[model samples]
Each structure stands twice: as C-alpha cells, then as structure tokens.
Target: MTTRTAEMLMAVVMGLFSVFLMWKSAELEIGWIPDEGPGGGAWPFWLSAIMLLCCVVTLFRWWRRATPESRSTVQFMDKNTRRINYITVGSLVALLVLTHIIGIYFSIFLFLLFYIRFVGRHSWLLTGILSVASPVFLFFFFEAMLKILLPKGYSEPLFYPLYQIIY
Candidate 1:
C-alpha cells in the first residue's frame, strides 16, 4: 500500500485501540477519589482519551489531505531498505524472546553489541564500551536508585555482588 493509505489505516487502528483502553480503564474508576489523589485508572483513561483525540485529528487531516504524510503517495521503502527494516524488527523480536531466557540487561547488552558493531558498522571499542556501560547504567539507575528491579532470568546470581554493594 501507498504511504498515505498505510498511515491512515494505522491511525484508524490506533484510534480504536485508544477507545478500547479508555473503556477498560473506566471500569477501575477514572476520576479523583477525594481522599485519594487520583484513581488507579486515571492515568490510563486520560492518556487514552488524549490519544483518541490525536487520532481523530490525524484522521481528519488524512481525510482532508492537510498534512504531508496524507499527501504522500510513495511506496514506504525500497527492497534493500525493506530488507534492513525486516531484519531490524526481527532482531528486536528475537531480543525480546532472548530477554526471557538470558535476562533484560544481558539481552540489552547483546542487542547493543549487534546493533552497534554489525548494523551500525561502528568501531569495536565503541561497541564494547556501550554494550557494557549501558546495562550497568540502567542497573544502577533502575535497580539501585529507583528500587525497580528488572528481570534477571537465570543470570540473577551474577548480579548479587553488585546488588549487595548498591543496596
């Protein structure tokens, strides 16, 4: 499909999804609770409501051909670019699956190595530095300071020392 048609179709789907989210969130009470600050569903409900509005505006723009995206009739990507896109998307899916097995931080490190070294054609030094540093930074930022733990899978034991120090 042409870019314009594809964009319009995706917008319609997003609009429907937003409507569904708003509907489901309403079941948990979306308004303020007087004593409580905001209801459990307030964030989701309001965020979905805003998303639905934006989708509606996007649909209107698409219908009127008011935006450049709506006016474009070009094919989305050439064959080589499409191949690269497919590979990138497939690798991300693989990474998600791998996360379940190897843990999030390890999977992220591997993904960074793959993306930076192979796909990005960057220097090994830069790739190695990033692959190691990013996950460590995330571990400190989330697991240590924020007190939010990410999945560790079977590699949880490896992180015990770091955790002991941080905690």
Candidate 2:
C-alpha cells in the first residue's frame, strides 16, 4: 500500500490501541493517593491519553493532507525493506524463544551480537563491546542493585558464584 494509506491505517490502529490501553489502565487508580505520590496506573493512563491525543492529531492531519507523509503516495515497503523487516521480526522472535531456553541475559547478548554485527554491519569492536556490556549492565542493575532475579534457565548454576558474591 501507499505511504498515505499506511499512515492513515497505522494512525487508526494505534489510536484504537491507545484507547484500549487507557481503558485497561483506568482499572487501577489513576490519580494520586493521599499517602502515595502517584497511583499505580497514573503513568500508563496519562501516557496512553497523550498517545490517543497524538493519534487524533495524526488523523486530522492525514484528513487534511497537512503532512508530507499524508500527501505522499510512495509504496510503503519495497522488497528490500520488507525483507529487512521480516528478518528483524524473526530475530526478535528468536530472542524471545532463546530467553526461555537460555535466559534473558544470554538471549539479549546473542540478539545484540547478531543485530549489531550482522544486521547493523558495525565494527567487531563496537559489536563485541555492546554485546558483552549490555548483559553485564543488566545483571548488575536488575539482579544486584534491584535484587530482582531474572530467569537464568540452564545458566542458573553458572551464576551461583556471582550471586553468592552479590548477595
């Protein structure tokens, strides 16, 4: 489909999704509680409300052809772009599956390695640094500082020593 059509479609879909999010978030208290700074749903509800407003503006602009994207009739996705999108999506699915099998840290490591080195065509030094650093940072932030344990799957035993040190 054309860019204009795609833009309009996405705006409508996202608008609906925003509305859904707002409705769902509203199930929890959205306003401030006396003792608490903000209610559980305050952030999500407000964010969704803002997103809905943006979607409305997008739709209005599209109807008026006010934006360049609204006026453009360019094909939304050529073959190369479609292929890349598919590959990226497939990689993400793989990452999720691997998360269950290996764990979040290792899954993210593999994902970054593949995406950065192969898909992004970055230098090995940059890719290697990011691939290794991301998992380490996440481990410290979530497991050490936050005291929130992430799934380790088969790699659980491997972290015993590190956990002992941290705990």
Q: Pick the candidate with the highest TM-score.
A: 1
User: Candidate 2: what lDDT?
Assistant: 0.96
Residues 47-138, candidate 1, lDDT per residue (tens digit)?
Answer: 99999999999999999999898999998677888989987998899889989998999999999999999999999999999999999999
Model 1, position 2: C-alpha lDDT score: 81
Model 2, span 88-112: residue lDDT tens: 9999999999988999999999999
Model 2 TM-score relative to the real fold: 0.58
Off by over 4 Å in 1: 4-73
- What are the lDDT scores of the predictions, listed in order? 0.93, 0.96
